[model samples]
Target: MNKWKIILDYFLKFLTALILIFLTLIIIFKFTIFNKNYIKNNLKENNYYEKVYDSIKENMENYIISSGFSENILDNIYTNKDVEIAINNYIDIIFSNKKDKIDLSKIENKINSNIDEYIKDQEIKILDKDSITSLVDDLLKIYTNEIELYNMFDNYINLFSKLQTILNIALICLLIITIILIIVLIKLKIQNLGIIPFTSSLMLLYIRFLIYNNIDYKNILIITDNFSNCLVQIVTKIVDLILICGIILGVMGLIAIILDSRKKNKKKE
Candidate 1:
């Protein structure tokens, strides 16, 4: 065997060990060592979640006005054409921006504002102040409904985000193991033309990634945002999964090297 080959074999083993260490450390940080809240919180800080809060508030205000006119007004708040657009916008603001913590108080205030305008159309009848006061009291029910809706959305985002994180972690581990195994098998069977097809496929896969994506192999980023963005999010986690596997394969390449060395020695003996 070439002296250089021996050196390379040792290097490969060390490299695999290093990768495993990193994986272990990060896993540790994720579950035990690091601040568990930081991931979602960091997501929130990425952009001003306050903006989403404001938008929800605005939607609630619109809901109030439409509701006060008649219970039929709920149609405008949820089923009306504009309501769909507003809901979509709000989703983008929270999910697109990765912020699930929504503020319903802002929304309640918005509903009340819209209701205030509709109330203006009612002429003040001083003949019965009690009746006027009663109307105002009844209108507050709309605020309650708007707040409930906002809370529902908040719960949805929270659950969705947690699922996203768990999926990412699982994919990462799979990719790393896949890559290491592939690389090790590749080195061991270097002379087997039969395995060339697999290598070709791998090369093509790598080329596809390099050409289309520009993400770091290590220290990947998982960004979340409020629900206004149209871009799909699974891309980030999937790409990370692929890269993790690739790295593991690269690190585990030494198994093939060792096997090949033993074969050459046997032939000589």
Candidate 2:
């Protein structure tokens, strides 16, 4: 009977550790990758949108400078930074989201307005307004039609929504299992509470390792520096959470072990 009881206690401790690890993973996913709206909001809050616009403007300027668009016209456009302002205004409109459907005409009008002011203020000479208009239209069309970029976001949102039901069910089951395991361990007079925090710290260490190993910083930078910055910021938030949880768990586990040791010492005395 004593041997069987010892085996049962060890089994319960093993199960408790697994449950703790699983619960930590679910919570991390719930707060990080699965939270679509939060990521979007964080991007906007961090001025990532503006940085993207700046990158686009720099790329466009480089193109206009190299495309043989006539020296004087290029001089006026680049020297006055007319395109930069126009692109910035257009990006602002895109981020505003004041309307349900984003109309190209709205962006066109905003850019046109900025361009008119730019021309008047800089006193620039350019014969073909239509040519400039056509160029801007083409760029806008290309930018908006980049479904791959937009689809990245759409895919994340869709994935989170799809997983919501499954996550809900799993979360409930895991939570119940955790509670039952805790109660059973206590009843068996085993120190399973320390396993909770110890498992949490181990899980956080694994998560940190994955984050460091999986993210290819060079590839992310090649895509866009602004995007890379945003990715780092988000990942940093996750890392911070991991560190906080690890510290708390490590402290709790240490305290539990110390107290358990003291109880044993008292029994010996």
Candidate 3:
């Protein structure tokens, strides 16, 4: 009977450790990847909006050169602020799970006005109204595509929404179960409560180590160089956050164990 009770205590500790591991993962995700604001903050930190504006201008220059128009015609058509607004709007749509298209009316109008002025000033007769309209359309398309990045986030929005809900529910359930397990373990006179947190901390650290070593996140190439840079920065930030949280938990567990040991030593004395 004593052996059976010992086994049950160990089993309960093991379950608590598993729950803590999961809880740590959910908490990390909740504050990092799954949070829309976290992504937006990363984008801002990485100067993503400015890089996007430059990429758009560069792409537009290619179309302008092919269309036999002076690249100067692309100047002042849009600003970094415009790019920021469009990108933020798209991000909001993705997070909100909306199917709305990004509004490019301001960019279109600005491009059309620039083209009209360029043609009128140069007195260029080779490019007619329809041809110039086509050029304007092509330029605006470049801006839109640069901002949307081929709709990479669209396919995952619904799935992410569902997963976020599930994670929240799982986190709450695990918290309750962990509390109950700890209470039961205490009632059973299990003194190694620190083992649960210590095990969980080790688990988190091992997971972080695996991800850092296995994934070549530094050289990750996405749609564009600017986007890829932003992705790398975000990924690095996430990894660092994981490391910090793991260390914090490990320290907490160590302190708890030390305190438990001291108390046991005093009782023995």
Considering every candidate listed, which one attains the maximal TM-score? 3
Give the residue spans of candidate 1 off by over 4 A.
Answer: 1-42, 45-48, 67-225, 228-231, 254-269
TM per model? 0.32, 0.65, 0.92
lDDT of 3 by residue, 152-191 (tens): 8778889877898899999899999988887888788888
Error of 1 at 8 (Å): 28
lDDT of candidate 1 over 27-65, digit per residue (tens): 533442133344334434433344444444454456446
Q: Give each prediction's root-mean-square deviation over alpha carbons.
A: 12.5, 6.5, 1.9
Tens digits of per-residue lDDT, candidate 2, 1-269, equal: 48998888778876776777677767876877556556567766776656555554555566556433422232222222333344344334333322233345655665566566657777778788787778677555544433124334433444445576678789999999888878877787875357567766777777777877886543455345566676777767777777777777778877887787888888899
Error of 3 at 169 (Å): 2.1
Candidate 1 displacement at residue 262 in angstroms: 7.7
Model 3 has a clash total of 0
Candidate 1: residue 253 Cα off by (Å): 1.8
Best by lDDT: 3
Q: Distance from true position, residue 4, model 2, in Å? A: 2.7
Off by over 4 Å in 2: 59-103, 110-137, 142-150, 154-157, 210-219
Model 3 spans with C-alpha error above 4 angstroms: 126-130
| Candidate 2, pairs of clashing residues | none
